[model samples]
Target: MKKILLVGAVLAASFGPTSVLAEEDALLVEARKVATSLPPKLIAALQDEIQKSGAEAAIPVCKDMAPKMAGEISQQTGWKVKRVSLKARNDARAIPDAWEKAALEDFDKRAAAGEPPAKLEKGEKIGNEYRFVKALPVQPLCLGCHGPIDQLSPGIKAALSQNYPNDRATGYSEGQIRGVISVRKSL
Candidate 1:
């Protein structure tokens, strides 16, 4: 009876941590799904806009339409979604909160240490909320506006100046992390 009780206690103790880990794993999966669902759509929209008009014309797709798409995703998924960066383009919208700032800083360090920027992501539970952030690596297409200021086309520069006078999101090369798609949900 003593041996049987000890075995049972050990099993219970092991299962307790396993179950919590499983729960965290589940949250991470869901958060990843929610976090990844936006960028492709935004990219497609930007491509279409650029093709129809020009890179200068496509500025609104990122500046305006991306947030609207994120809003729609938030409504559909019950998770709040937004973009943030260490060097924000839209001063009003792209500033990272404390947690997001920490995650972005960590991502940059990891990327600098030779981790692929595309694979840099972090997800965990904080208080009653599950939060996730996925790095948005700068693509060749993003360089029209997000590349070095000296290299930007005159039209693109004018548009950015007119729209976001205080923009700081520039000087990024391909594969560099531009920002993160941050998502959170109350658990």
Candidate 2:
């Protein structure tokens, strides 16, 4: 009886996921791949720029090239892709709508509760679109530009002031959630 019960429990656990859950998980996987593909390239480009011309030179790459790359990704994926944060440097692009705001808040809580930001994500169907967001944690490379305001180098500060006079995307530590890659697909 004990052996039979154990086997039954194993079988049930193996097959327990509902079809809807399975589909959602698959959707999340697709969403994550599209979302994650850009950052690494952007980081590598920024690294090259910094190494060749210094950290200040990388500012334009992030401010201009990053958006262009994101736009290309959006064109390829046929889904709206963007970056947003609680403290957005670019007011036009970083502002989160109501749903995105809620998701970011939830992500913060989960990360606070020991969830790895790299593995953090949220997705849901809203009206006619399926929305997804993946947390972007502050990395070591990010600190040079997005670190504590007072701690920034003079050149970096001047560059930021000239480029983004009203920037608010600072005061972040490594491993902290800096922003999110937000994606949406019409259903």
Candidate 3:
């Protein structure tokens, strides 16, 4: 009877943590799905706009349409979604909160240590919320506006200046982390 009771206690203790881990894992998976749903659509829209007009014309897709799309995703998924960066282009929108800042810093360190920027992501439960952030690696398509400021086309520079006078989101190379798609849901 004593041995059976001890075994039962151990099993219960182990299953307690296992269940919590499983719950967190499920939250992470759902958060990942919500976070990932926006980028491809934004990229496609930007590509279409760039092709229809020019890189200069595509600026509105990122500056304006991306936020609207994120809003829609938030409504659909019950997760608040936004993009953030260490070097924010639009200070009003892209500034990272304390938690996001820590994750972004960690992502940059990991990327610098040779981890693939695209694969750098963080997800966990914080208080009453589950939060996730997926690194947004700079792509070739992002180069026209996000590359070296000196290399930006005159038209692109003018548009950026007019739209975001204090933009700091430049000087990024392909594969570098440009920002993150951050999502959080209240639990």
Q: Pick the candidate with the highest lDDT.
A: 3
Q: Which ten residues in a row have the lowest lDDT in candidate 3?
A: 14-23
lDDT of 1: 0.93
lDDT of each: 0.93, 0.88, 0.95
Model 1, range 1-187, lDDT digits (tens) per residue?
A: 9999999999998789888889999999999999899999999998899889999889889988999999999999999999999999998889999999999999999998989998999998988999999999999989999999999999999988988889999899998899999999999
- Model 3, residue pairs in steric clash: none
Weakest ten-residue segment in model 2 by summed lDDT: 14-23
Local error of candidate 1 at 1, Å?
A: 10
lDDT of 3 by residue, 62-161 (tens): 9899999999999988999999999999999899999999999999999999999989999989999999999999999999999999999999999899
Kindly list the per-residue Cα lDDT of model 2 for residues 64-128, writing each as its tens digit. 99899989999998878899999889988889999889988988898889889888888886777
Query: 100, model 1: CA deviation in Å?
Result: 0.8
Give each prediction's root-mean-square deviation over alpha carbons. Answer: 2.0, 5.0, 2.1
**What are the runs in model 3 whose C-alpha is more than 4 Å off?**
1-15
Q: Clashing residue pairs, candidate 2?
A: none
Ranking by lDDT: 3, 1, 2
